[model samples]
Target chain A: MECLEVYAWLQAYLDSGVTAEQERAVEAHIRACPYCRRKLVAMARVVNALERTSDISPRADFTRRLYEALEEEAGHPLAPRPREPRR
Target chain B: MDLRLLERCRQGHLEAFGDLVSRYQSRIHTLAYRMLHSREEAEDVTQETFLNVYRALGTFQGERFSPWIYKIASNLCLDFLRRRRHSTVSLNAPIGPEGDIPREIADETQLPEDVALAGALGLDVQRAIDALPPKYRTVIVLRHIEDLTYEEIAEIMVLPLGTVKTRLFRAREILRVSLARSD
Candidate 1:
């Protein structure tokens, strides 16, 4: 396979979702090709970084806050009244 | 505790709605954070998502809650991204507290100091991800981080399978190039 096609297969191959036959072809190409291997490694690094990003847990009071917002919105008058025609 | 609570929520029980909020708030907030890369926005989006979900709960038919909740969060995230784009804002640019910075390639099991050093790189990588356009970023996060199948992502994104695959590939390429530039 050409370089672009192999690169296209790189993500699925890493994901281990490609068909076995196609997987063998990708594995063979990457094993023989240094360039494709490097591209795969770079992609893998990005995936690694994504996995390790900050946790960013929600606030402890989030439930309270959500209810408060819900209450506020619920309390609001729905449907604006029609204004009288201006002279 | 029971699906009956969800039914009550659908019927407009305030307490039931509160229960739903308590149950799903974390997951909603996390999805928002991952999507928007902004804590405040995530919080706001999560609240909005629950409120919207509550209003629309009667229409939800599936026994499983995951897809329904995710569908709401993803739609809000997509709309937010679109509006931000129209306004020409860079959502990936850093904002708010820097305390929860990510750890880089360094061993996660390392000493606190080493972990701190790695965090800077980790934060940079996340920012790079945040910088991605919504289409690509959504695919990357769903497929890799969220561990959702491409078929599921395609269903959620309402795109063809081939289109999803193309977006994911190009997203990875963009992230790779961004990392190389940083180094």
Candidate 2:
């Protein structure tokens, strides 16, 4: 029963949206169940790290270069269309 | 900025095409960069994505442009990843323009230590994500970083709801395991 509850809430917990009551219950369960606790921590850690990671913004001239490339491609007679036939 | 410009672009108004590129270029490039983890490939994919978008603009329904453009980019990335898998070449190794690599910037919000930790973690996370199968990686990126809902991911990937959820869960677990091993 407890495992079922944990499994159900695991994704939500990783997403950092577990309700207060649910968080309390899950933490209690983790304290008593080493296996579940380890799995929970690992999952939580990955998510936490991901959320904390720095965003690498693209180059300063990204937009300008994209336009240049798009213009170049748009001028082409053979640019690949979404529905174009493939060999 | 407006759909009418897109319409004009679709009608071969060159300036309107420039407008459309201005509007979506950043988004398309960012998506490509995140998916492929290589700036050069991302640039190539971004160019290709817009070329396809321009050609298909006439067929686009009055629906949201966000999902439409993303759908195109996602499909292209998937195909590229699949083709990469067939070859013995390693994509993880950097292959791009010489001496034009973008410098990594430290965020103002992060102190020295936090910035370092963030960079380290981000590199590992990206590596793990790159190692994932294209299908799983696509869903994960769309759902997590792109902040699309399950339904949206389903639409983007053209998969059923169950498959999207299953792939997302498995992708997260795979990332977790890979990151743990790296630690």
Question: Pick by lDDT: which candidate is best?
Answer: 1
CAPRI tier for the interface of model 2:
incorrect
Q: What is the C-alpha lDDT profile of model 2 across B1-183, one tens digit per residue?
A: 567778776666667766666566655665666678667777778778877886677788855777778899998887777677567555342223531121232223423432332334566576666667666778777776666788887877778988987788777877777777777
The top-ranked prediction according to DockQ is 1
Residues B1-183 of candidate 1: C-alpha lDDT, one tens digit per residue? 546777876665656655565566665665677777667788888878878876777787767566667777888998987788668744243233631222232322334432432323365565667667677777887776666788888877888999988888877887888787777
Full-model lDDT for every candidate: 0.69, 0.66
What 10-residue stretch in candidate 1 chain A is worst by lDDT? A78-87
Winner by TM-score: 1
Fnat: each model in turn:
0.39, 0.27
Q: Write the per-residue lDDT of candidate 1 for residues A7-85, one digit (tens) a residue.
A: 6667788777788898988889999999988888888888777666433446566665666665577785322222211
Model 2 DockQ (Cα-based): 0.20
Instruction: Write down the RMSD of all candidates, one decimal each.
Output: 10.7, 9.8
